[model samples]
Target: MVKWSISILLIMLLNLAVTSLGNVPNFDYHAFYFIHQWLPSYCNQKGTKCCYPPTGRPAADFTIYGLWPYNDGGNSLQNCPGSSYDVAPLKAIQNMLQKDWPSLTCPQIGRKFWLHEWNKHGTCSKSVLDELAYFHAASNMKNKLNIFEALSKARIIPNNQFYQVENIKAAITQATGYRPFIFCNHDAEGNSQIWQVIFCVDKSGTKLVNCSGSPQGQCAYSTVKFPSY
Candidate 1:
């Protein structure tokens, strides 16, 4: 009788293991997108005007958009429960964020943009990185890949003329040895322009990997404009 009970317990444990193997955490993200945007095109998006952060107008380059986490199915995590936006911890890195991740939207009122990013994307990343660590990780990633400089070196100047998006990707791939995802948005004149450049990173938000689980925002063109700011 005892042996039969022991055998039943073993069978139950085996069943549990098999069930657990198929049950992946729905809340978890497999990869992160180190996303940044062309500030000029960002401001040019419909009904938007450039509103520099209190720190002043940022340089003409790709600025940090967000470090978004996504699953294998390309679903991005946002506004995770329990992680609220707080600027208190960001005091130390405020200056750095201002320069690298400044918001071009109006009523900046200090760290509001950062706050939004933290609440939306950073919160979802709490399992992998805390608030300070997440911002630092994004700033570090932005510093590592100078996308603007890479394009310039490749002679794909952003002077409001259309360039083949493939060439743009090639320039980035050649520089970083990994492909990048370029997303587009409509300029005020209804022309699709290169808006966002996304790079894939490992779960820790460090080390560039081949692109995966990153958003391809509204881009269906063979050639797109890299507009002037």
Candidate 2:
């Protein structure tokens, strides 16, 4: 009789543990960042040298970086199970991608950087999107938030001019109706330059959402440089 009670108690305890764990939230990814980099700023950073894509020099613009998944704790999710990156599915928008998402590294190659982004970050976003859908969403996002145009409208040309970080954020916010987080890099002379503009995105990866956490890097300087291409 005592043994039976002990066994039942143990079973009950095990069941309770399982139930508690099951109720725990899936904090793996509830939001994401639609991140893009300023090509001129990137090329101007200290100890950096950039090469144009085979098609030719891309225009002076903020280029597509990645659609990164983020957990509630602000950790980026990566390497989840999903299809590997393939160019076949992206043929329809190949030209657009080449223009917006081109690799600026030495010995630039077509689709290589994209393939890396897909396998590393895009795969982890499979619960909300597929390979083709992911790339398409990124393209749509780029079209929607024309950062260059937004800044240009504010007369913030990338001609080695310095601007307050708050003003930069204000321009993007005024244009998109969603606030952006800016990251900075240092120029050859160690002056801070804006590198990436990141926007928060919801789980659907469709619409804009407010970001939760603070941005990394030093964008808090009194003035940040906007380098020319």
Clash list (residue pairs), candidate 1? none
- Model 2 pairs in collision: none
Give per-model TM-scores: 0.85, 0.85
Give the per-residue lDDT digits (tens) of candidate 1, residues 70-140.
88887788878867887788899988988899887777534888888888888888998999999999999
Error at 226, model 1, angstroms: 1.3
For candidate 2, report its TM-score.
0.85
Model 2 lDDT tens row, 1-229: 9999999999999999999999964636878888989887777766777887778988878989889998877777777775888888899989989987877876545688898899889988888788888888888898889999999999998889999889999999999999898888888889898888999888888899988875455376777899888
lDDT of 2: 0.85
Which whole-number lDDT from 0 to 100 does residue 49 have in model 1?
69
> Against the true structure, whose lDDT is highest?
1
Off by over 4 Å in 2: 1-27
